[model samples]
Target: MTDTTAFDWRSFLLNWSGEWADSLPGGETRSEGDEDARRARWLGFPPASEERIAAAEERLGRRMPPSYREFLKVSDGWRHAGGFVWLLAGTEDAHWHDNESGLADMFEEHLDEDAGPEERQEADIWRRGLQLDVESDITHVLMDPEDVDENGEWAVYTWASWRAAPPERHADFLAFMRDMYREFHSLRAHRRDGEPEFANDTTRKLDAQVAQARSAALRGDWERAGKELDEAKGYGRPRAAGLGDQIRRLLGQTYMVYFEGLVTDPRYAPELLPPLVAEHAAHSYRDDSTLTFHLRGAGEDLVSLAYATLERVRAGTYRYTAAGPFGTAVERARELARWGGTDEAWRTLIDALPLWEPLGPDHLAPLGWVADPVLGPLLTPERGRELLSTPRGGRTGEAPRPTAGLDPGGLAWLAEPDPGDNPTSYRFVLVEGAAPEELPERLADGNGGGDGDGTVLNERLTLWEARRRLLHGRREFSSYDDRALVAVGRAGSGWSFAFDGDPAAFDRRRFVSPAASASAGSDTRAVVVWSGLRARHGEPFFHLSVARGGAEQYAFTYADEEVRSRGRIPQALDPSRFFGDGEDGAEAERSLLEAVAGEFGVRLPRHAIVNGRLHTFTTRSWTRPPGDGETYAVIHLRGEADRPADDDRTADDDRTADDGQGSR
Candidate 1:
């Protein structure tokens, strides 16, 4: 029950005509080059005459609602992008069941099958419907007059042909309009945290470039505008698209490859434009906003759209739509990728960050998709796992692992060997009752005697809790100063070794990108780490550690991000990626080498693994080394195929942990 009087038709119309859509809801139908021309070139049909409006109502055997009827009188039909419509048919074109572009036709096709009892009852009359014209081919806006009552307002329902479930129901047209308005802004804005700021010089340069693009578009200069768009898109900002869209709308020429041999291979004996892709033609435009990748124009628009996704993803401001055409403009850029060839494909895969939805699953996940030559080469299956999983998991596990197969759409990964032990799962002990120097080599099985000082309790933990502690840090250990993290894993098939070190030394996230190796083939094996090492580079590899509290003792591991999050890690995620995390190939090599040895051993890499925060304790402080001495010495694990014999190191280097981090 919306208060109709509260409607701001003026505001709605002003926003609707935004740089496109040529009147319609933003204003009555207006042609391009009119007094107040903006970016869009599409036009709206002439308003319905009184007789025509009455005839439409008479044909339907029901009086038109006042508001909707008034709207139609302003513009009978429209061809536009942005405000939830691609084509708003006039009364003559409206139909109850025409497959090509009929709203009622779509409704019947997905009606009862995807509707609940109430919804089905409402659709039985087939009152009215409109297509949303999003990236996906099958979705629509429907109105049920049966339940309208004398108030003349009808509840609106959205039908997505891709959905096998009930259509989404909104209270009425106003509600639906509100939702579309929000989507419109979001599509244009992308990130809500505000436009990314540039440094003084970059800002001035980009601002100038954007103004030039705008100026060129205003004067109808497509060529100059495009070059400006090219330069601006290279930087992180949304303005580039807005400006380019303006120029594109002004040009008014879209070359659909199917209709025109634009990208056809001249190399082919019978050269022809690539085969038609009419399957998703519905995705070409937004009712009121300008289109990217629309009509197979210059693929640069798709490139800009894709790159924008990366900026938002890295900045931690991405949000998937509540109702997806299933895929986003960024996701749809894959088509643009193919249309534009290898370069466009590469650009889209990198910045678009295509997602995977396992068959039967409606939601998309960032990782676990099988390797695309471009995507696979660029990312690991676990690369953006944390960013994609919704509702987010706890920070209590060892780290997330690739839970599926390479072909994201296929179920082959399910048939593969379970990677066995997860790296994130750990059973460690944080000794609160003992000083850092007083704990035994085996804290879990300790005799329980140490130079007591401030150590007040012994907290043994499941790996999940251990992970939580690593992510959370010493917040819970504030009352007691000394703590030891005994991160555990099996080193060899025959013998298991525990990493006796400080929690401060273990960080799953590091500045150095671990060189990601090739993905694991079907034959790849999962090896256990008795907690002595993290794979080289980005991994939380293991090493022996010793910290000073009252006494000098070994500690285990923890995760730290490059940015200090204070606990909220996502906000601290790297704004720009520093790639490379030790890969599937490294794990395979380690497994093969271990199998070849067929013996018990553990070894250390050349890097020092210990990390800590320095505390300025008094000269007499028990945790400090009696005087102005540095923290305790960090030893190296003595075994495990020592390829680099000099790999081991002592804390003599005096290095420490960086601020923020992540999981697989």
Candidate 2:
């Protein structure tokens, strides 16, 4: 998609070659010069001192894991020190597509909930693949000459690294690790009062030695680092759990950096960078390094830069669509009008809106995430379009309201059918010409037939007209609410209602509403469903439409039972909260009770009850009003849990331990 007038697709492609640097021979090696520079740049960096490692180990009072020792050997070449990897959240399943060769089968299998055990296992493995993909979260630190010890015994030290935590916070993580180790050691004993001492005597000695060694290493002492590591291991301790793996990965990075430096080709860095960094970061749950380290190693590669830019743009777009403030304001405004709101809060929200000109020349995009019908007045149509074109972050979009307004005297209808008994019910009717004039045509003719004016279309047209008149002059004010419109349907046992299609079902045929059905003069199943002309039993309803070109049959697809049974309705539009309780049938009993208690201005008692039962409703539609007239209410729940016994004693013990650590 083009972003600005200056954007040209062809030019972009031509310029993209610079992004990849130079391709390696047989796609395995980079050119000589770039490789040499990268290696030199990383190797020139200083390695972590042995004394620092020793001191850190001393602080933890445990022998660090082998992996961790390996990591320290190459810590100097750590590429990235930024928190870029750690901040990336959420799984990347949506990125999969049909075009992926090996992954396509896996993707399709995952879509099938009823797939056999083998298929399910395959899908699970696929999920785990995505979950464990090194690129998902990682930091890379290349090894170099400076990473080795004075004796030429190479040690790993991060030089250029990905998956590095925020520079400021890295030290904090060390402290956190140390503290957690102490806690783990405390839990080893498992006394009657709970873990007063270390049950694993070996681990206790290792911890003390490692902590001291690390503390000293942090001060740039090398001689003591080896001594501490050796002494801690002598205590017959197993490897440290969390810290060990990281150390090992770091060591690997150091070795690779040294290896690459020895090699002349620059492509080696790029080739090795992506996978190595990815692997390291993956094992550590660090995501930021995946991007930062690669970028750093890549240097002037324009293709990589473009990709990075694209990622940034995409992230920006996502935030713009999903969590931006403007989108929130729009929704808030809608709620304000539906559920009564203080004028001051409303005005404050409006004033907070960033300035945007309506149809103005400025090229600014609308903030999609934050915009809603409630905040529509603050946004211009142009701005909205701009926001739609922006890239997405790792977040999803919120629901948008329907464009249509509410009509008064509106005859809202819902239909449900029982699967075991009767299956079909009247959904809606589309009549031609006029409502009254079209009714007689079907009944009088031997065949259910219609002329231009006598057709069932007339009846639906008449219904639409009547409803519009009742809802006339209803200017858009409130947000459109899909939740409130569900109850309006007449439901039986089996059939449920939906719009467009449902998402969770394995079969698209079950819920998809063919696009052609909604067009004028169309004759698809949607038209049939909307028309309420025929009541077919359980064999799923189908109809052919000729709106676009040639006619094609459309089917009433069954969606997942959950979506069909109880679609999520936002509580903001529930009428009983605004209108008095008992205004509806026995269903309004809770509202009635709440209203009665509210009159005395006293809070009601809160209780916890577990109602372990599952229920389903074959719903069609709900009785929700348009933005112009609907009301809403906000309900808040609050409570607190009592503390466990011996809380004071526990606190005292923890405090004493902390104090002892500080003194040491």
Candidate 3:
């Protein structure tokens, strides 16, 4: 028998058998020898006599490692060491690896002159190592006698062909066996078969550890919880694996977590399932890392049921039946969904998540509802962003809404311009004391100028035609070259107008404000206004920024019914008053434009912008910096630039001129 004070081999074997029984299905009786062997694999064979061990040692001319000998005193051999390894050899079967398999010849033949000392040592060790595994699936367990330590324990290695990795080394046979036991647990954790009840003391001890870890996690002692769960997991407890994953996710170490085993009890399913389903659906297609549910057994069926229920919720045919805060929240969400207020309903559910409590120790409560059956299908992807867009405990107060309006003054034309197919998305940069002809140069210098040979072309076209040409350039050459086009002209007496049709251009507050500041001449003021009639998601947006003396003075943006402002916004141009209380998004946007135009004393003649000609230039404002080992090529497509003679100067020519000027 093994010394209980050291390693209790009998108890370890018993725990291993219990875990094996819990994982694998039972009741199939095989023929005599096969059945006996299979039974012995789990329960283990009787301990070998001292005389038998001595006879085997005399035959092999080497004494067995202390741990291996002690293990033999408990059980002669082991079986199913892990997923890959099969039967471990007993005294009667153990032999030298090289003598039996002759694989040392293959290792020597492949050994290179440049092989490192460690590699050479590994190859030589394999040649004389004692084999511990008598049967395996392309796997071998070896003990190196020459690598004995002070304790007289030989170094052990587990090599598998399918791994394509070097042999995994362990300090001794005991350590190898312990790792194998842990591997068995990890592999079995994913099984679809039922987990049988483990009545063993070791299992009870591990389960208790997991329970304590859960309590610790709830008390916010996450570090302690993680350590405890990690320890329990080492003993092959599936509950520990599940709880550890949850702790990792809660601590922000990972974005995904998983639950194993069957979860069909109605008491627990409601509290446990929604978050897992939602998180799984949310990150299913994520590119960075694989996030999965890890659901097995009846858990799979439960997920399928949840999906069906979600479809019913979307169809307005499902009703939550349970009582309590969560059920009430669900009902509220259902009512909102029925009334076409899905986003509001989703918010209602999300707000109530913190109040959710677990029904059992195994359940993790208050997960996101983005994938909940009753709310997930109703929540649009755009709205679902609310689930993780902000840090936990960081959100407070109601979202900002547009409640103010700005007076149009002399710039009323901006609020009511010619509408049909007019460039709805555009930006205007107006610099005082900068002539119309010099506006392009100022902007080119402010932004990082392009890189190409000097070639400048001046053309005049209506704002509509200019926008079309810019869009055409974007579609045609965007694959090889990043480019944009801007129409420059005199807006009023002292303001030079630079307009871009791309809505996203100068959309970023930092970029637009800095660009405006850079465009201002010494002691001169510059103003930039960006307006988008309808974004890709159908939301209108407006932004205004003012710069003076080579620095930005004020900036404001109003989008998605929210306002963001920085610096000292003039009271006359306060975005809160830029829109009337009853105004829709489009009207609000127009009102904001009028307010900006009036504040900056900027006015663009409608007739000139709509029909008259204006000087247009191509800019490389959107070109991305080249990555490592990356080069760019410019290809001018034939028949694509077939515009009027006045529009002959392509974006490429202006980029080359800008590049030349920037170089100087």
Candidate 4:
């Protein structure tokens, strides 16, 4: 709420002069000489005497609101009350809205049938309100005597004929005047020459507040600084708003594209203006609304230079000179940009932003430097997205390194010929305090003890042999075979590891079922990590699940670029920190794997997964038609017999079988 009692009307309306119209409706006509005379008076008429106010109120058969009466005492009338209002009525000229505009019948006709009581009442009040403005751009400013508050202030409303909406209601006349004052400042700020520097008492007081706020911001007292700046902005201080935006950017609250202050100081303009101009230019190209660059006189030369540099950046010929403490990081980013790795280059700079030192007392951060000649063109749409999505806080330290768990990239060979081809599409499960040999039995237990039939065979074999068997089955039996080869081994940290080659094994009811049930015992836990390299054909996916004492403690899945989670995932394992826009699928998977490995401190030996022997088994379950009802069966096979017949083997199967020979 505005402090209407303390508002200095003269100080608030200081220097209020602009071009005036030739004439006003129901008011005196103004010639060029009369307009010049009014401009000299600062658009304020002499204060109305108490006798004049009394006569006007007696004619209207009502007393005026306290705020409006107070305003008339300060000035009989005002010109250019806001951007739209042209002339405000003096006490003698004021009249009832119902007797003049005749808008009640039209409003009643257009009112919706489902209009609420408040809306209907508002329309009714407007019909009898006192009209204040004599001329406007299809705008009406009214005060309702029937809606007086405890302070004897009437509610004020402003409606525009072209808006096709209800009139906006203000708490009182003071509030309406405050809004108009703010509008005046807002419009003034956008002028090509920018807002004029005001030396009035109000501006001096607001400037002191802004200085105090800046000191508070420097001291890291953001809350206090924000409150002070907000108060100053409410008073329509342009400098306060600009500094407030700077603080928001520092706190990662907003990514401000345009700044308010003129950057004419030679000390800061060279370092700041390029990025401002580039960002403004980039935004102008992408959006229909173009922003004005508030550069005037000597500052105009800097803008011209910035535009020329931007042209070179777009042509891929711009070079950035590394400087200051972050020179090495800037050089690295420059190199990355040269190769068309725009996202990576931008990320590199973003990572180094926290370490930037101010060139002088006025500098904020490296945020504006993102449009440095070398880096400006790298601000592609995807790079801009990455910038916006980057986490709020500055980087804590270098990314965590994997000490225990398998690098997800290391396992890519299981699905593709090389780790670089695509992210390996496989599921890796870790169960604590469980032996490798017990995995198959636990899985069989979860599968209802294998159909209660003797034909459900289980035999131990090497990991390589199991891989051959799975491949042979898929090629010779069914390309979409439901069979899964579960290779059990010992992972670091006393946790048992199970590697399932099937892409769909991440399903809770499939391979994860046994681990979930097995870890149900006292003091046991299970963790599963999966990556689906669907980016080769479509969108990529990643999933993580943690279970303890038979209950799922955490479950997270990132599919189709959206995240879904149940329970709390550890902060260290958050996938968002590792993911980036336009990131390669394999690189993204690798980064996620590293985070999980660092969090859990567990690792799987690469040799064991690809070549070494381990207790491996093939598990499959399906339903068959029965004469009476449905018959279900489970097949748990192991050893060389699990391999498909030689006559039915494909060329890939022959290769896999040959690879398994020495390991078995």
Candidate 5:
């Protein structure tokens, strides 16, 4: 039971699929056509019973290599395209194929009779057969079981009726298959989509530039912003679905309105400065008496000098009463300009005063509710209240309220299997910028982690650590697809295909579920289903797949390897159980939500339920206080919804109404 470093050949060839062929040029992949037949043919024939393989060996005198023998039981022969391999040969056919008798002498004699020194040399090296199939394809690449490698496995060499150059070698049949499929997919994809250099360093540079441009635009600098975007425009996306292209697209599409007209107005208007600041910008400077507000405003000098002026005012005694110098406290702060501040400086000071109770009336006036037209609309009523009532804004020991959105940690989702499943491998879906080592052998059930080259060998994340990592958007996956997760209990399992028994019986317990009918209103959101593998029938295949639809529907799916649609994954979570879709459901649902809130420090927002699943339109957050008694720095789970929808809006409306605070 020692760990095997070799690529697991028997499992791969057994599970070898032609599904990758669809990734070739024709966009409409595996449609209702010859594609299925082609896939079956390319995958090779079904298993050759043990008796059949034994007959072939008995007739051959010599026993077959263990790898080759094992392969025979999986499939007697590749249906049509096992890289030009044919059926196994008995002794007589082997003798002829190997040229074991007088074939070489005969060829040499024929060359002598037709007599030429060069031709005679060409005939000198007679080819001896290894595991020769009964029939050869147009070209033949033979697995030489007799010739072993450093690990005592066989070597592979190509042979044919005609010779052009020396044959290429592979370490073993499994290694040979790996090379074959690598080329096969490359050729297929090229045939389908035209060759392009994808996922390279050049694309990375463009991504970096696009991200920079996005940052500049967010800070209200259009000129500096457009320059970076313009430089990155030359590189068109490598592939449409890849993360780089998606990132570039998002950068160009979002936040344009914020920068559209701001460049012309260099002056920081009170209406504009307040909205430009980030949520993390506020810092309790020195002590609670003075707070630092960082701004990503119009100009460096304008912003810096404005910041200094505010620091001076903060240094001195400042008061904003109902009756100050002018009609309001904000206008009174404007009076600072007469003493040395610019108009922009005055605006900066006023913009930040909404929450500065030390300088304003004794009321928690969050700026998101500012009366100014420009500031009011952008600062949604829901967000404004969040600034005041959310746990992130609350004092120590006070819980943070949940905001609804996507999982900001990452779009990828993973599931913890039932203890009874005894699952050994875990899968993560829709992750970006991840390498093999980060996920390690954890990603697959078999010995070789994906390609079977067996180089992947690091195990980094503990189950909860993995959950915390993905909840925060870290890259545990290599792709940008954020909609799947799978874990397997046995070796060589994947998505359930042509499986047996009742599918619903295999769902994992204790996972997050969607609500049935939300009290908020008529709610239509996404649902997730976890599919357990029926491991014994074929290859090991366990999957948690998303029933794709809107952004809300596809919040997260727990998956480990490449995903496949194997019919509908059974719904494990009933929204009714958690959302009171029917009567007698709310008390338990609310209790569970409350418990989860207590642990995560977030109140679960409005949500619906389906079956056994819990789906809340709320962001979960946990604050990690600094070690050694430090409290200023804390970590929280941030939400990043895929898109804004009615589910989010409905939830917000319900919260605002229930709390009896109209935007705080």
Candidate 6:
């Protein structure tokens, strides 16, 4: 049943032969110099070079079969004188056997013809070998010292030898290798279309399972169908954990069919229509170059589907796997349905699914174990009721009253109450005297319900208003006459605090260092710098400078390198942790106050850190128990004194501070 001409021993021997013995098909094992052995040696069947075989065996870490070495003597070429013999073992083509002279001629001819191409081919061969070493290489086998029996010695188990075993063993080895190769294959096949079939058994199996699932569904076994489909999805099949996608497509159609039946007969249970409606409403997406798609919709769909699928199984229409998505979906859906969808229920769901946690590399949908994106909105009784109500009148509907627990005035004064009793409105409050036109462009757009054109003006206006109120009642003076003077506010951005001396005209102007220009993306929040001091004339000095550039750029600047270096000002501040989409603007404004306080050695009760891309801060209002004391003090790295007593040797100020009691 086999073709002899198809077997090219010369190429086969050079390529697939892992063992030297396997390279020698048939050869005699007679003792050296024996007449019978010499004759066999001349026929291409000769005993192997004992020394070479033993050394090769030692290096290879495996025993050589005797039959292989025996076949190599006459085949060695230089030893056999005249026409010789060529023998092959089981399954080898017998016609390849020929006169030894002809075999030798063929070998020499190939060597002469292939020299140049062989060199180029060898480079490619080496490259291929290196790749193979990376992919599915057994060199990683480590003999675990702890797993050794009794003694401290370890055993070298051979994955290769096991892999090369007979068909039955190969099947077992395939299973082991499949798991072992998962990571390697993932890298090679990541987002790569057209992967070879042999390397992608997982995907193949999943496709087959999808087919099987559809078949099961057609036979009216909804649970069996859903379970099979879920298994294909659970192992991260069809590129990432693709459960939602399959369920949506399969169950969407299934539920639609059920809906047709329900609408026709009111007794058909309106309960099932919700799941069908939810699935249809959810978003659906397909990844580039992938057969799988996701039902990317609101998490409410997950609850509906999970509940419906579970109820169907409970009602004896479907069967399921205990640990799969269908199983968990069922359990969760039942809980939400039974509890009447409370805040506690949504909280439990959140405890299971945290926001932004990825499901899988290729999966866009978060696993059911995690919470949904619109979790906060979903907690509302109105939304919850819409998601949980059954079609028929099994559960009663008694809506609760609004404003159930607080005085009308108190409720009005408090920022929106924690989401309870169906509260769902958001509002913003502006600081007093805040300019109506200088707000940050984005804020203006967000507040005025317009594009971001005039938001920056609005933001600046607010800052001016707050600063004007804060600076009120402060002392001011004229140059010659003892006339009462005022510091008027104007439009513009940056540090604008007033001081006894003209800070704007101070010599040694601070310029933006080029190095500071390197970072340009961190401009979310403005950094405030303020200085308060007392001069020898007994006049209080105050200065303020606000950085308007991006936080990515360096924050501080001074004319003297020594001054800038010694001050220890932070070069950049990431505002991500301070503010988020939720909550009132109080938190961000409070953070702005703290940054200003830190530069002036003013003690404050709050601290702020940017965490998870939000500009969040700890403030007096944020403290668990409101108090009057400054729990945390903000101090400049360099204290309020312009210069240390020992270091104050300035050309102009040397005589004034000699007594070491400089003005406070």
Residue 577, model 3, lDDT: 84
Per-prediction TM-score: 0.29, 0.16, 0.47, 0.46, 0.24, 0.21
Best by lDDT: 3
Query: Per-residue lDDT of 481-500 in model 1, one digit per residue for the tens?
Result: 12334323222222222232
Model 3 lDDT on a 0 to 1 scale: 0.60
1-664 in candidate 2: lDDT tens per residue?
Answer: 2112233422322222221122112234543543543434331123347676666556544333333343344332222122222111111111212122243353464466676754443333322221111121233211122222333322221111243321111112222222223333333322333322322334555777666554443222323644565444333233222122212222232332222220112333322233233333335443454444334433456335334433433222211221255446545544432211223223434333332221111112222222121222222343332232222222123323222211111112122122332213322222222222222332222122112222222211112222343235432211111111010111111111121111111222222222232222433212222212113423222221112221223222222211121222224323324234223222232342233223212121010000000011112111222222223222222235623222222222323211121111
Name the regions of candidate 2 deviating beyond 4 angstroms.
Answer: 1-365, 368-403, 406-411, 414-664
lDDT of 6 by residue, 365-457 (tens): 122221221111223333232222211112123322221111121112222222332112211111112222222321221222121232232
Better of 2 and 6 by TM-score: 6
Each prediction's Cα lDDT score?
Answer: 0.34, 0.27, 0.60, 0.58, 0.33, 0.27
Candidate 3 residue lDDT tens string, 1-664? 3332288888888878766755555665544643565555555778999999999899889998888888888888877788777688889888887745655665667789898877766677677898988778978889999888777888898887689887789888888888888787666655454545444556677788888777655544556767888887776676776667654543333353554442344544553455454454445553313322344445556657666554443333333443467668877875544322344555676666445555656644333343333343443333333332322222233332221212222344554543763465667677888777675566553342231211232455555655565456332332223344666665566777766655443333223343454455678888877676454445677777788878888887776667788899988788888654665756776666667666767766443444344566655443333333333333344465654222223333434312232222
List, residue by residue over 94-151, the lDDT tens digit for candidate 4.
8988836667676777779998877775677667899998889989998888787777
Error of 5 at 428 (Å): 70
Worst 10 residues of 3 by lDDT: 400-409
Off by over 4 Å in 1: 5-11, 21-45, 49-51, 81-84, 97-139, 147-151, 158-170, 175-433, 436-461, 464-664
RMSD of each: 24.8, 30.4, 17.4, 17.5, 30.8, 24.3
* Prediction-by-prediction clash tally: 46, 134, 8, 5, 51, 39
Q: Which stretches of candidate 4 lie over 4 Å from their true place?
A: 1-42, 99-125, 161-169, 181-209, 227-239, 249-257, 261-356, 359-362, 365-664
- Global local distance difference test of model 1: 0.34
| lDDT-best of 3 and 5 | 3
